[model samples]
Target: MTNIDVKDINTLTLSILEGADSYYRWIFQEIKPYLQGGILEVGCGMGHLTNWLLGEGKVLVADINKSYLQMVERRFKNHSNWMGGIVWDIQEDPPEDFPLSVHTIVCINVLEHIRDDLSILKRFYKLLPLRGRLICLVPALRWLYNPLDKGLGHFRRYSKKELCEKLTLTHFRILTLRYFNLFGAVGWFLQGTVLRKRLLSSVQVNWFNRLVSLFISIESRIPSCFGQSLIAVGEKS
Candidate 1:
């Protein structure tokens, strides 16, 4: 973990995440099937996910932080599939100019930052057309939450039951819902609870990244009852 203040913690975290290429590609594989038509990625953040999704479709990135939005746009503006980006606060109603052409909305590690996550899920439900998909990945296990969660501005870590219930309540028919990153869960617990670390170390992330393929292999064959994160795919029926 680098020496950083709370306000800059997100940027620091994203920087660290830049090295977790294998981990993210594991995520990309899980959600790739659901990605279709106009893809509206809710929190592009330094465009890590956006980079993988460049030529996938009409990729429109949105984020409340204008600086992050502009940075992501500038990073991929020249791509043929880059539809540009917009500054959007998911807590409020999507702007009138929000595109109706979006058939899928991808939210990665963003919902945990919201206080009323249900309201935003409802908004996403309203924003999509029939059979449109809502793909989300969020940190799991509230018991594992640590100072790292606080510094990263996470409101709460989600439970499998809670996520499913919310998606059901929001009128999204569940497609794929499951725990992910089994090894990462152990590392998170050790770092946060056992070691009592407030920030992540760059060396640790790179080490973990190198082993992500092995983790993916193990996770694929073994059905996990719990994990460090949850990936849910819900369809607006």
Candidate 2:
């Protein structure tokens, strides 16, 4: 699946995702009711999700990587209400300068990268207002753990039970947890068992991304017997 050159996944996937309205909307709709006050997107990478939800609300894109934020800053330097991306390391205590009580925080496909996911969840619990929501998306299933996972610095993929236990222990009421991107399971299996690699061509990545987006757009109507990622919704109590 190595054909197209995307330069960087964080920035390039945004273009591929532009055609994936249903996929974004599925997630957007799930978080819409919770989008009040302000939003802090942890590990926002190149702010693809930020750009995806442009003009939606008061948004602050944050990440530990300044280089990544540079790319993101260049992308959204002109939009009003663009709260802008900042350097933030979730594993560390929040910088006093950061507005921690922003009502909403989004951590997308990011928890798996942290070795102490619970600690970070606990931090978010403290950072939000009472009953505030946290949007979490993690790569799902142990079988999907491949070289690509390691290459991108992922610590682990998650099962629903494991994720629920961790968040529940940290005092987050589990709202929703389900599998997403069913077709991508095929690519994951191939990569983990066959190719044993992480490099992806633009065409293959885009095509598979589209296929998974198609499945996830209708994931609500499907059973949870398949897929390669988990998106869980929780609220601080």
Candidate 3:
């Protein structure tokens, strides 16, 4: 296991994990179709899904953030069957040491943060072997922009059409692109636009977080509904 130097690893884990259990469940369900053999997760912050993916064969946790990568490595050292972490640079071009051949790639909530999302997509498209799958999840609704979005370093939110066009341009055939987390859209609207809260207090976030997950659970039991986030599964063709 690689060592991740951080003053407060536990706090970081707790921060991301609080509202993410539901999101991760939805993500796993959505990404199940594309996953196989060698898999790579871009921007795998704090090993949220790292431990689960490690159970599968040939799982590589790749991110540019050295600290995040180390956190994953140190946390999941017990699962050594097929586990490794790599320092990956998605901008410009993939670093030489990063895996050249991969079957499935999951890029979640990281595209908007990237300076050149399209170029990264193109490079990812080329990196995959024939018939490889790519799972991409990006924030939806450009109007929901707020200070948290800026603080998180997101360049832009994506609409369904805009995201699809970019994916198509990258030589990927969109197998599925559906909206996710509909309730969160309303939450974002209220906080991002109406109140315009820059950052969230822990208690406030936990309360809203529970509400979001509860609504998501209800939605999961029900049939279907529109969502604020867009999740797409594409294949290199």
Q: Which candidate gets the maximum TM-score versus the true structure?
A: 1
> For model 3, what is the error of residue 142's alpha carbon versus the real structure, in angstroms, after optimal superposition?
1.2
Looking at model 3, residue 63 earns an lDDT score of 81
Task: Order the candidates by lDDT, highest first.
Answer: 1, 2, 3
The global Cα lDDT (0 to 1) of model 1 is 0.89
On TM-score, the stronger of 1 and 2 is: 1
Q: Rate the local accuracy (lDDT) of all candidates.
A: 0.89, 0.74, 0.74
Tell me the tens digit of each residue's lDDT in model 1 across 45-147: 9888898877578888999889988888788989988888998899988878754398999999999999999999999999999999999999999898997
The global Cα lDDT (0 to 1) of model 2 is: 0.74
Which is superior by lDDT, 1 or 3? 1
Please say which candidate is ahead in lDDT: 1 or 2.
1
**TM-scores, all models, native as reference:** 0.95, 0.84, 0.84
Off-target runs (Cα >4 Å) in candidate 3 are 1-14, 97-101, 208-214, 220-225
In model 1, the runs with Cα more than 4 Å from the true position are 1-5
**Which whole-number lDDT from 0 to 100 does residue 25 have in model 2?**
58
